[model samples]
Target chain A: MPFTAPPLFPGDLFEGAARLAASAEGRLSAVSEAPARAAVLDALWEEAAALGWPAVMVPEAQEGAGGTLEDLVAILDGAGRAALPLPLAAACGVVPAMLPAEAGGVVLPFVASGEWRVAPAFAELMRDPRSPAAAAATEGGVLRLSGSVIGMEAPPGATHTLLHAPVDGASGLILLPLDEGGPGLRRFERLDGRPSLDVLLDGVTLPGTALLARGEAVARAAASARALGTLLVMVEAVAAMGALVGQTIEYLSTRVQFGETLSRFQVLRHGTVDLYTRHEAARALVVSLVTAAAETSVAELDARTLHLAKLHVGRAAREVAEGAIQLHGGMGLTDELPASRLTKRLLCVEFDYGDGAVHAALAA
Target chain B: MDAAGTDYAAFRAEVREFCLTRCPADIRALVARGGKLGRDAWSRWQRILFDHGWGAPNWPREYGGTGWDLRQRHIFDETLAESDCPPQYHHGLRHLGPVLIEYGTEEQKRRFLPGILDGSVWWCQGYSEPGAGSDLASLKTRAVREGDKYVVDGQKTWTSHAQEADMMYTLVRTSQEAKKQQGITLLLIPLDSPGISIRPIRTIDNWQHVNEVFLDGVRVPAENRVGEEGQGWSYGKFLLHHERLAGANVAPLLRQLARTRRLIEEGATEGEEGRRRALEHRLLLAEAEITGVRALGHAALEATLRREPLGNTAAVIKLTSANLMQRLDEIALDATGHRLVSRFRPVDGNAPPEGMEWLQNYLYGRVRTIYGGSDEVQKNLLARTLFGH
Candidate 1:
């Protein structure tokens, strides 16, 4: 139920979402802190890729689901609701959500057969904000790529960086392969516990087939793709926090104190109420933004509304997690309970794409 | 931008035209401006809706209601709210009307349903006692059975609009031999009956709308009782179910959201610096609320279409809706500069005195989370329902 007034999308695209969610749930609980986190993530990815879930956002004329972003929103929501925190959105929408129909053919083989694991790197350029330093030069039909690709926070286990470069003064993407020694590449722990990479692409050559989009369309593609990636993480965070809120309330009800349940206390109950209210509200706004972004350009969507949703959700995730910890007393501080793990994720996800302060500043 | 299209769009237009033209200008102006909308205004608006056969859409068609589906009713509410028409006072129309249609005898239906629709009778609920708000089953209001009358005594507190209500559908202790819930029975008692006295309770805003209803040996006909004896508990829960579902409707709040936006646009500042901070908070709250309503509404509708019990989901809606109402009011306070009062006293400076209006609206909105089911009560219900308490 993506908060749009109309039906989210064709029903068939989501019929198996519940099944996917159940499998993820089973796999997640069975793994238990999952000594192999990246392996577990890949396992879930393989399961979804088996279902062509990755191609749902690709236009159908290109031999994909060719469905709208709304279809992917449902799958993400289901995964989120079940606490299945796989990067389904990145797989389904990140690269393809903003790609032109012509480029859909290029992305088709990678998506349909799971041949390439592409992750987008849409970070701020150090010197010039309008264009990245990753400039491409073409002479006599020979293409060369140089400059740095900063802030490519591609998660662990990704094979390629979906790089948006300035070629002939236009924003177009080239799917750059990550090779051995990772020339000019520095990878580190992301703020959200994932792996982030920064690369300096000094004089690299690529076939023209690597061009995802060209001309002014690249600007639209780049902007929408970045927005899509942010939207996915933000919406997923909302779902995860919502699950946490439910878990916290359930914990309070059963966790007895002073000869009664903790929920019996006015202060804690009111705290939960406040947390719950903000969570629902933030989720609603995010849904609207999803709807708007699908219909119009990402830049055309209401900026203030988008910022408000991000800021509220980020703040709410912290508030609910911290409050849940406080109410659980000793157990909350310990890793024995899921709250400890979830709270960390909630705290870290605030800085995933950007934090509340970033959103608030933009909103202002 | 077009919101709803095809049939829904056309229906929305029809409703907009009907509510805009038929609802009186004075009442619309009063509601749009925001206030306590005294008894006369409420009754007039309800009567206007009743005349158009649009009042009490939740009631069955046989009982003079429009028999609209839940979504249709929701759209109607949205349209009326967007038009700034006074809300159809819900005491009788939303709360008790459905209970009567479901549990009332033919005589009871004929006797009570007309007034609920036509505004000839104003009704107030009498369930909350001084000590039995969240734990309402512990109510102590007593009704002793006589040959054809029941001698009722005890006090009902927090009865909204009780001073103006022609009647009160009350819950009274019918049999002390059973459990707290089973011993209670609902009795429809006229407000003007002998031994019944209503004391007005002025809220924080200095408005006298709710009342402390005290009854001393008030005699009520046996025929006035709804359903069977010792069943008031069930009927009370049923009424609450109605109230909670109605609370889920985001229609009225949408009106306030639009009004807040209009106010912000009208008071455009050079930098919008300070104003942006204040308005952003309001928009955040409002957007969350609208989306929550949509999400919850969809969930609730799915449950209904599948013929499953709603089972305390309504409590979720009521809680969030109340918080949003209060949040919106707070924003209104900031937007109108009503929060800038000196010594905690609101001082009005402009004509139309919009700041005072915001103050009153804020004060009135304070009861949102309290009355429908206080924030505490809703949590308890949710805890019990979800955790099997």
Candidate 2:
């Protein structure tokens, strides 16, 4: 008998993604800089819109396309395979559920070591403690906004910032109009050439409704949401690792050293085996978690499962990513190659919610 | 599928009921205490199944077995595993019995098969020697032909249950000049024969399951050789195939996991959500993998019953099952915390609960993938079967 498993998803999601990934191969190869990358991201957004990705999670009654969690996983798996650079995971996972619909595609900045940073572009900035972007409270009917959020980014068509804050003695999400925010908002050019900004919210008066409730309920829900997004990031990292490893294996098969293909060397074969093993381990764990989330209804339990998946996948991702680079010789580190891009993205994903150390301590 | 078409369901229910009654209360208590049965208990348990004629369900009826089909065999294995019953002496039921049935003379079969069925003669395998383990075909245990006997000399290491065994079935080199695969012969040697000695090798887990058996001019009658002279290589290979099939038992793992789930549920507090969920997730994944293995095993057994070639797919089952066993033990240790560190005590009231079995199983499981042909060897077999040499 063939080694068959239960269908991971109900319908054509996996198949669709696989096709898209195959078709976009040339497009992905042509893209080099952030401007071209942003255009590719726009094209991806259009494709996602065509697939109704944004509406997959929304309830059918709430204008959603009536897709399940499995559907979302399939779509993300596809995105990973295609090496697409859209923030679909964050948008679908974090924004619609955690923040209000008006927030409009929030770039969820991750907080690590008391520093706030946006991923895919890890630019660090100092918090302006005097601005509404640093708002910590909303008393009575007035919104007492203070402090600044560093590492804010305004991509090509992004209209607003779905900023995160420690509000009223609790961490909450807020929608900040980037264009309306004063000189407090300073734009910084990133190494990856993406447009990022530092928003200062000093003594800004705002309506109570502007404050998204940072209650325990919201925090719990948001954390769970963030976990789902992190899971996709992990899936993407695995896919990229797969591609790089495949390419390296192909190169080694053709490249001769000492009168034989590099692949013929026992040492290289063993190293490749190690890489494959770690990659499979990560894939197994991630797929298992995705299946778990689909089959269960317990939110807290799902959150925990996602956390463990992140920890395992993060650690494996780093190893596989680095292994891919090492195997590719000096070409792996240069910007001219895709391996470096994968490495950078994987590094950012590793610290997105928490690193291996943070999650491991929590899990333990 | 109709209810009757699914014969496994009915067989599973029947085996479950049998285990609930025939499995000794003490054995259940031991399992409850996270202990596996010792040799003595296992013998009694085997006899219980023998009395019910359920012993050796995988063997043919002519050889004192149930003669069940593949699905039934799977049901029996699944039930046995889930019940946490004492492990039957596999050396007899899984290894020697099948080998003898296929290759033993009628007189040999009549004498040994019944004893194996009744648990009267405990069996141990003497395949691995001090000098030959992974390179098993290169065994140097010499068996020189005498007038009416073969003089066996050399040592066998890692002989399971050798201390308690009444007889041992061994592979010995019969001719030095013949190719490694050509000059070997299989001999059934009595453990109590003069010049045969056994010394226990205490492993890191402090268990006595393994032993080193030395044969200094031990002599066995000519009738003890199962097949033709210098044909032991083929017979040993056949025996290994059967052994691999028997080793792919996933039921015990399921039972252990069920126990782990209970322990986690009972011990962990409501606030320990992360640990609880992680354990639960692992349990589910294990269940899925075990189910997959069961399906694969059932398919292999069915092919065998139909007189079709199993090829090297048997190795696949063995490989997957060994991996699952290792994973289950790891999860068990993780679930029990420091309890795993304690030594194992006997199931009897006078002896403290022997917690050592879990540790022993963990250590033993590490060698499982390496033994019975390393996983790499199995994969190579698979690759050859798929792509050819």
Per-prediction backbone clash count: 4, 20
> How many Å off is the CA of B146 in candidate 2?
2.6
Quote the positional error of residue B265 for candidate 1 in Å: 3.1
List, residue by residue over B142-220, the lDDT tens digit for candidate 1: 9999999999999998787888889999989988889878989999999999999998653434356667899999999
- Residue A222 accuracy (lDDT) in model 1: 71
Q: Give the runs in model 1 whose Cα sits over 4 Å from its true position.
A: A1-364, B1-6, B268-272, B285-289, B302-312, B338-340, B343-352
Each prediction's fraction of true contacts recovered: 0.00, 0.00
- Cα lDDT of model 2 by residue, B311-348, tens digit: 76678878888788777775655444222222122211
What is candidate 1's CAPRI-style docking category based on DockQ? incorrect
DockQ (Cα-based) for each candidate? 0.01, 0.01
Instruction: List, residue by residue over A1-364, the lDDT tens digit for candidate 2.
Output: 1111222353587677656655655675566444565576557555756666666665554555656777777776665654554555655554545644333232222111101122221111123212233545778886666765554334434445555566776766665554455325444322222344455567666667656556676566565556666666676666655655666677567655434666776656776777778777777776776666667732544556666788778767766755655554433434445445454445344544454534666666
